[model samples]
Target: MSTLKILFVLYPGVTHLDFTGPHQVLSRAPGSETIVASLGGQDIEAEGLTFTNLADLSKVDRCDVICIPGGFGTTAAMLDEAFMAQVRRLGADAKYVTSVCTGSLILAAAGFLKGKRAACHWAWRSLLEPFGAIVGEERVVRDGNTITGGGVTAGIDFGFVMLEELAGRDYAEAVQLGLEYAPDPPFHSGRPELARPEILAQVKARMASATDSRSEAALEASRRTEPA
Candidate 1:
């Protein structure tokens, strides 16, 4: 079997689990290779965790699959014209393109989500429309060659789904069983509707801050021609 080369785009402040969770699973697939790509040549810090540099974005030609993770860094990445252009270019050559959480926003910014259904962290779902995507509420959404996951943890489910698509249902099920994929949250507050009023309020406040920051970055990106 030919090896599947996978490229993961990472930046400062990225959510480690968003990429790592999926990478661990996908890399376990038979004949799969994974590389972490960054803007320049330097280590990246993710929520106080540092990841060694793997490759520069400029050196990548094509990948079998590409994954982008989300966090505060995604807000800046979405606004970076050069980054967006590179995403667009790479996506065109990739067999599959995936995003977790608000990383969908980066794909949207790159014009990859147009007229496609995609999933993103619920807090940022509304913004998907601006990029011409049909925002889906599912934990994982597959639209043609684009696969998106909701929130950070949903990347796990997304990986399994992609595995089933790439490998086989039986293979995916075996992996899931090996990983003990059964879930049973002690609390029923996983969704917004199940959250307490106070908790909901706090979440809303945090989202408001993120929205403001993204809006500012979007404005700046509109004014600038390319990323620095």
Candidate 2:
């Protein structure tokens, strides 16, 4: 069987877990080759670590899958025509288009999610309507060849699902076992509805600035890409 080429779109300030969680699964899947690319070949910093030696966009011609991870920089990326153009170019012919968290916003900005049912971080789920997507509440939502995951931790589940699609359920389950993917969170407060009211308020308060910026950027992107 031919190897599957998986392209990961990287940028500054991307959340580490959003990228790494899925990567850990996809990289281990049989006959899969993972490639990381950015606008330039320079190093991009995430919340904690720096990703370096990334392939330049100009050099990556095509791939079987395209995965975009979300983070604080996703807002800035929505405003970057060059980056979005590259995304459009790369995603135009990919077999599967995928994203985690706010990365779906980037895909929507690039005009990829129009009329699709997709998922994103709960905090920003409603923002996708302007991009013509039916927002999904599930941790992992797949419509046609497009798959989107709901927040950072959802990437792992998204990854396993992708693996199953690529290989098989058995293969994916084996990989999950190898990774010891069982999760038992100490607190049942992962999402707003499940969290305490006070905790939800505090979380929203802390994310106010980022939410405002992402909202503004999404509006601008929608306007610029509107039917003309």
Candidate 3:
């Protein structure tokens, strides 16, 4: 069988779990090859963690699947012409185009998500609107070949969904079983709607600064770029 090449695009300040969660599952797919890359094949500082030995984004020609992860750096990434250029290049012909968490904002900035249903981290989901994306509240939203996941933790669910689409239910199920992919969160506060009022307010306040900055960036990116 031909290999399914999967590219996980990375940048500085990325939320590690956004990429790694999906990477853990998708890398195990049969006949699939995973390529991790940064803009310059340089080391990446993801939150407090560091990732090295990444492929140069510009050097990578193509892939069957292209995955972008979200982080505090989404605003910077949105404005990066070179980074978005590579993203557009690889995504233009990829069999699947995907993103995690706020990564959807970057994709939306690329003009790929205009009028397409996509999910972003709830805290920043509204930011997708300025880019003309149909914001979805679900953990994962698949519109045509473009799939987007909500928040950081949703990448795991997104991965299995992508796997099922690429391989089949049986294959995805087997992989899930092998990974012991069962969730039983200790708290029922994963979402704003579900969290205590005080808790949600505090969390929202914490992200207020980033959200405001990203909202402006998203509007700017939307105006400057056209849908590809």
Candidate 4:
């Protein structure tokens, strides 16, 4: 069986869980090969954690799947033309183009998600409008070859679905079994609609600055990529 080559785009300020959660599952697939690619192949610091040995973007010629992760740094990436050029190069040929959380915003900025129904972290869902995407509420949204997950934690769920699509249900189930993938969160307030007023206010306040930056960057990217 041919190995499934998966390229994960890692950048500074990444939310580590967004990359690692899905990575843990996808890497374990029977014939999967995972490559984490970053600008200049340098070591990256992700939300206070360091990741080493990331491949340089130029080193990759092609990949079956391209996964992008999200974090505060996504705002900067959206504004980077050189970075988005590499993203467009890789995503143009990938069989499946996927993202976790605000990563969708990056994909949209790269022009890979125009007019697609995609999901993103709820706090930034409005940003998708500039990309012409139909925002979805589901944890994972798949529109043709583009698949996007909602928020950082949704990567795990997104991985399982991607595995099932690539390797079949039985294979994905076995991976789930091995990982003992089951959720029983003590808190019942994960989403804005579910969280108490005070809790939601605190979370929103914390993210306000980052969200504003992302909005500005996403809008600019949308304008740049619009059909003339």
Off by over 4 Å in 2: none
Expressed as tens digits, the lDDT of each residue in 50-157 for candidate 3 is 999999999998999999999988899989999999999999999999999999988988878988999999988888898888999999999999999999999999
Q: What is the TM-score of each candidate against the true structure?
A: 0.92, 0.98, 0.97, 0.97
**Ranked candidates (lDDT, high to low):** 2, 3, 4, 1
lDDT (C-alpha) at residue 57 in model 2: 78
Clashing pairs in 3: none
- C-alpha RMSD by candidate, in order: 2.8, 0.9, 1.4, 1.0
Range of the 10 consecutive residues with the lowest summed lDDT in candidate 1: 218-227
lDDT of each: 0.83, 0.92, 0.92, 0.91
- Clashes counted in candidate 4 amount to 0
Task: Pick out the ten consecutive residues of candidate 3 with the lowest summed lDDT.
Answer: 219-228
lDDT of 2: 0.92
> How far off is residue 81 in model 3, in Å?
0.6
lDDT tens digits, residue span 98-161, model 4: 9999999999998888789998999998998899889999999999999989999999999999
**Which structure is stronger by lDDT: 1 or 4?**
4
Q: Candidate 3: lDDT of 55?
A: 99
lDDT of 1: 0.83
TM-score of the candidate numbered 1?
0.92
Query: Candidate 4 — what's its lDDT?
Result: 0.91
Q: Candidate 4: misplaced stretches above 4 Å?
A: none
- After superposing all C-alphas onto the true structure, candidate 1 shows an RMSD in angstroms of 2.8
